[model samples]
Target chain A: MKDKSIKMLKTIGLGFTEPLIRLFSGEEPAKNGKLFFKQALLPLLSIFLFIAIWYAGATALYNSEAEVRIEKARAEQGEEAALAMRKCIESGDVSCQPNTLPSPAQVYTAFKALWQDHLSISEKKADFKARVADTNSEREAQGLAPITYTGRPSFLDQIGTSLKTVAAGFLLAVFIAVPIGIVIGLSASLRTSFNWLIQIFKPVSPVVWLLLVFMIVKTVITDPSIDKSFIISSISVGLCAMWATLINTSMGVSTVDKDYINVAKVLKLSIGQNIFKIVLPASLPLIFTGLRITVSVAWMVLIAIELLAQSPGLGSFVWEEFQNGANDSNAKIIVAMFVIGIIGFLLDRIMLSVQNMMSFNKGIA
Target chain B: MAILELNNVSKSFGAGSSRIDVLTDINLSVREGEFLAIVGFSGSGKTTLINLINGLIFPDAGEVLLKGEPIAGPGPDRGVIFQNYSLLPWLSVYSNVKLAVDQVFPKMSSSEKEAHVLSYIEMVNLTPAKDKKPSELSGGMRQRVSVARALAMNPEILLMDEPLSALDALTRGSLQEEIIKIWSRDRKTAILITNDVDEGILMADRIIPMTPGPKATLGPEFKVPFERPRDVTNINKDAQYKRLRNDILEYLIEVGATRRQVSDQKYILPDLKPTMPGRVIFGRKKKKDKVKYF
Candidate 1:
């Protein structure tokens, strides 16, 4: 059972955990200790090396800039003024180089603060809900519509909103591309006709698609009250992210093993039955790979689209902080950068597990 | 009564000058519960011929008839066990067998269908491996699953395309025995396409040699007079088996020798001396280019 657990961990692309698990199980302490040292310790050491380099570089650059500022103050006023200016930069007073790259500590502090802000927002929301519950009942008694909370979405709420937008766009792309891809893949004439269009539209970047979507959304959706930015961003994401899925699904469907199709034909499966029972199942691995890529592309592009459209999401928060150009804003932006990277990593992992569950070659997945 | 018949069936790929005929002037019939094997080299178009019977493909000329009626497309009446054992890698052994049973025998009660699937799995002696996927099973076990899947459908005819060709010699021999055992009990009309001569003789009631390709055609048939449930150990002692094997092998040798002789007399291209660019790129050979043989 200990051996099996190690195998399972390795299979999930968590090979680093295998050595650790083995060490705990006391199966091969010496061997696993060496493996644990090699796999786990080495990567951690490299990360520390990277952080040390970054910290040294940041401290040197900022101190030099502060020296220049202090020298100018001394030239203009006196030694006391220069000393005070140097003290300001050293103590991390927000007035000095607000847009400077944050040291690791600042980023960590920002992360903690962001969590606290989210927690306070949650409490405020709960308080709002409690206050509204009695009023809502009274309003119902008087046959009036219940009042709604009118507050800016919190940082966590923005993360949730971003996730929702990406999910919506991704699902739409899947529904549109997979059917079209299957039809194109199965028929030569259909593929030929669509090939030119696929070639033309596939390379069009998200930014370009966003501009086109902006025009269409402006003309089509006239209601100013609706969350038009969210809709626009979602549609733009769908347009840009769809090509990967379309190409992969087609390639996968077309290249399904000939023997399998012969088996399907020998079984006298209907066209619909053939697609669902044989084609889809056989092509799932490639399809999921395409979907995972599409989700990542959607995520990378969503921030830009959200920022441009001024949608209330992380993209806007980052953009807003960058514009604010305050000392803490730099650290907050750094925090957002890590959040995006971690979320992208998580999305890929979620897709991998889904692929593993459905695919025949589960271990590879 | 003839359960399956093919008349003047010719299949060719490509058109105009590029056209190559695969099957030509093929007229054949198999009686009910007859075991017919077609022996040939790989890429001999025997698979194409089998596909015609299964209605996996259409003949350019003439027809393939199942019973009195023509076969339009493949159906539950004809279950094919493909050369690759085309079981879905995603499905377990039970699911692979149950896929056919569920589709072809939709009217069967769920309990009845489950029982039927189990019975075939048990027949193939794969009860333990029934929950395992094809990838987990060995080559011999996968072939058994394929056999079990085909048999579970309980079709009027069973078509096998070198189903045991991929297994090792030992496994092949054992599987041949297993197949023979299955045939004796079920007595389903079957066609076995194989390159292995011994395997053909072992499993089939009638062995037909297929001529070599570019365009392959059926040569001659040898009927096996060996009694039912004959022991493999007694094959050497059985004069009929030895005689039949010799006759088929002799016929195949003659066909091969004839084909080689014909190809030898065909037009041959003259070997040109290396061109200026070719000499420069490849570096000139020291030997004098003198070839005057016809």
Candidate 2:
């Protein structure tokens, strides 16, 4: 059973815990302890070292900026004005606080602040929903639209919005790429003819895709009720990230074993059966590889697309925090940066797990 | 009456300057319930010949006739067991067999189809591995799955293209016997293409040698007069088996030697010797009587 669990852990790419698990099970404690230190404790120590470096850097920058502010005050006015400026800065006044790099403590405070803000917004939303329930029912009876909160989304809501947008874009990419990939893959002529088009479009920037999508979506979706930004953001994300899956799928399909095709021919299977039973299964490993890359690409480009489109997502939240330039704005931006990175990492892990599950060749995945 | 026939069939690849003939004038016929073995050197177009009869590729010149009817393309009537096992790696042994059974016997009820697939798997002694994928199976086990899949199709003629060549000797020996046992139960017109002369003689009713290629063709056929259930141990001791094995080996060797001599005369290689440097550098002393033959 222990061996099985170790195998399962290795399969999921979390083999680092093996030594710790072995150590806990009392199997060669001396050796396992050394391995556990190398694998686990060392990484934990490195993380602390990184945080220390960041904290020191932030403090140095803040002090330098504060010193420059005091010097400017003394140069412009008298010593009393410089003293007042120093006092204000020292008291952490919003007006005179340095807007440079924020320290770890400030980031932690900002995280707590964001959580509190989310809780307050949640309560207000619930209260609004309850208050509008009767009016919404009446409006439904009269065939009219109900009232909405029309309030600013909290940080967590932005993350939720980002997740939803990425999910939609990824689905769009799969829907557009896989069938086209298969069709192009089956015919060498089609693959050759379309090669130029894929090469040309694959490297186009996300911002350009967003503009292109916006131009089409603005004219096509002129309805006032529909959220054009969301549509434009998702479509741009899909277009920007779909190249990997398309190329991989086509290559995968074209490279299916000749023996499998021969077997299909001898079995006299129809075209549909030939593809589904033999071709698809043979190409699944490559297709999943493409999908894993597509998902990571989708997540990487989603922020830039969302920011440009002004969608209520993490990208827009980061932009808004940067533009706000309040006392804790830099800290909040740092928080958003970490959030985005952690989310991207989690998305990749999820894709890898799904790829492993779907693939037939366990070693390749 | 012949169950499968090749009439003046010819096949080639490429065109213009690179054109090369692979098989030429391949005329043969397999009578109903006869096991015919075609043995040849590797790359002598044995696979091309089998593919012609299976209708995988059309003959450039003549026609391949099955039951006096010309074949259109590959069909379930000629079940081909590929040289590479060709069991779908993603599918279990059961599914691999069921796929062929489903396509050939679409009208068979679900339960009937299940039983049919299982029976073929059982015939190949692979019932325990029915649920395992080809990737999980050993090379021999994978070939068994391939055999079961082909057999489940219930083809009128079984076309095996070096099916057991990838297996080890012991596995090949056992599978050869198993195939014979299965074939003898309800005799099927089968064609076995192989490079091993002994294998052909052991399994086939009539052994035919394919001469060495650029344009390989079949030689005279030798009839195997052994009775039902030929014992492998006793066959080695039999006088007839030795004569047949020797005759086939001698004919193959003679043809190979003549082909090599004819080709040898065509190419006159240039004879030039490389000249070595005069002295060996970085040495304590050069040998006084050293031969500089480069």
DockQ of each: 0.43, 0.52
For candidate 2, report its TM-score: 0.91
Q: Any residue pairs clashing in model 1, and if so which?
A: none
Q: Quickly count the clashes in candidate 2.
A: 0
Error of 2 at A276 (Å): 2.6
The deviation in Å at residue B238 for candidate 2 is 2.3
Where model 2 places Cα greater than 4 Å from the true spot, the runs are A1-13, A27-35, A70-94, A363-365, B264-294
TM-scores of all candidate predictions against the true structure: 0.89, 0.91
True-vs-predicted CA distance for residue A42, candidate 1, Å = 1.8
Query: What's the i-RMS of each model?
Result: 2.7, 2.3
Q: Candidate 1: misplaced stretches above 4 Å? A: A1-13, A67-92, A97-99, A143-149, A362-365, B16-18, B264-294
What digit string (tens of lDDT, one per residue) describes model 1 on residues A1-365? 87787666655657688878878978789998999998999999999999999898777776677778889999999999989888887786777652457789888999898899989888888899898999999999999988876786777899999999898889889999888888888887888888999999999978899999999999999988788988999999888999999999998999998888877877778888899989989998888888888999999999998888887788999999899876688889988998989999988877776676657864311
TM-score of chain B of each: 0.90, 0.91
Judge candidate 1 at residue A60 and give its lDDT: 79
